[model samples]
Target: MQELEKKEFERLLPYLYKRKERCPTFVFAVLERFIPGFVFADDLNSPKTIFVGTDSGLYFVGGPISNVAFNKHFLKFCSSKLKEGRRFTLFSGSGGWDGLISDCFRLELKQSSRYSFTFHPEEYGVKEVQLQEPFTVSRLDEATIRSSHEFNLEYYERFWGSAGHFLDKGFGYSVIDGETALAGECTSIFRGKVYAEIDIYVDAEYRGMGVAKKAAQAFIDHCLKNEMIPCWDCNVENLASRKLADRLGFREPSSYSIFVKNQ
Candidate 1:
């Protein structure tokens, strides 16, 4: 497979936009901020298939444009990447990639259900609420990163690599109880300049309170102010998150299937 240059990468916009909800959001953001290092079959001028990788152990396939089948060359390329020791979760529209590898190689595919939710600013009516005792909402920044609870530190480290990266590449708000972070809502995956996937976490002790709700509202407000749209995706089994998305004015999530390689 030939690597696609930036100009060539832009040509996939129509295909990507056509399957917006099906594609991962980070693809959009990474293409905007970083070089995709994307590879495609044929020349960049017109590609029949596209492939890109993610830091989160995912290999994304965009298409087999114009009814073309993914050939042996591309499958070998995928095998080479998989041999690098990263377990891959493949995201492709429909069932095209279902057994493309297993049929030729020893690996297997395990499919799972996923959902995507989009926010509508017009449907969201911000509610003014009183700041009760010990509950405070504040924008997460360098100062807060240093002073926030261990949970927040672990969270930033896990998803963002470092608090510094989060500060530079992400934005969010935290609900604090005095000095402790009770809950937070931040961009887990940023997609282009216009969309971000929301990630929220609340301490187990504080679950029944409206901590997440308040923090998410503040986070959504920040997105709206900057003209960014917020997206929420969760496993179908996570009922609590599904309810939260509904309460936050996110439309019903669109369900999609993802193939995760069995480890």
Candidate 2:
């Protein structure tokens, strides 16, 4: 067993690039952004086969974590000891990724289960589409943070929750009326200097209002000002999500499939 540090994960930079041109893996991008890649490493026993991410938490994608493997001190060092809240995955592996990470918590699995959307800045252009009266979008700030109301914890926990963290990191904008979040988006993360991601969410009552698409473009513009790229991705079967991504000029960058276990 081997150990890795948060800042030392950049050694896995090559894998980040390999996955970037395709779908952007959320965890890979998050760790890469939050820490250096030298700290990230492939499990030597697993080789070019499996990989793991270490930080305030430990996430695995390459191999099955047998009791011995998960308990090893080396593994202990990278994986999170606090098993309370939850962690998330952006975009990731193929048909077999779930089998490879059976030891990961159900929460982590829930976070990674969604298909990723990758949107490009050059492909995104916004017209001055006005919103319905009594609604407006403002920059996210301390006040805005307090003003925003999230409707669902589970959806936010997995998808929107990750976006919220990223929003707190960089520039984010929200659409609201009287403190209600009709829809919102943030400049989540960068895949190299060339690409960025727009994480958007719309309230159930506010669907079809273009709140998601417009707010998403605002975040994309913000990414451009910061010298990054952005994209949106969604599952093919998700008609609404796919339509929203398409409205914002995002297309499927690669193939993706979803998995779930009926425990």
Stretches of candidate 2 off by over 4 Å are 19-25, 33-40, 43-50, 53-92, 96-114, 120-122, 151-168, 178-196, 257-263
- Root-mean-square deviation per candidate: 3.3, 6.1
Cα shift from native, residue 16, model 1 (Å): 2.4
**Pairs with backbone N, CA or C atoms under 3 Å apart (clashes), candidate 1:** 28-192, 29-192
Model 1, CA-based lDDT: 0.67
lDDT by residue for model 1 over 1-263, one digit each (tens)? 67666666667666666764456776665556532334454546666566766555666665653433345566677667667776667665445564554465444566777788878777788574455777888877777667655436666665456677777778878787877655554444454676777777777777767887887888788888889888888888899988878888888688766666667
Name model 1 segments beyond 4 Å from true: 6-8, 18-22, 34-43, 65-71, 99-107, 126-131, 146-162
Query: Top lDDT: which candidate number?
Result: 1
Per-model TM-score, in order, reads 0.81, 0.64
lDDT (C-alpha, whole model) for all candidates: 0.67, 0.51
Q: Could you say which candidate leads in TM-score? A: 1
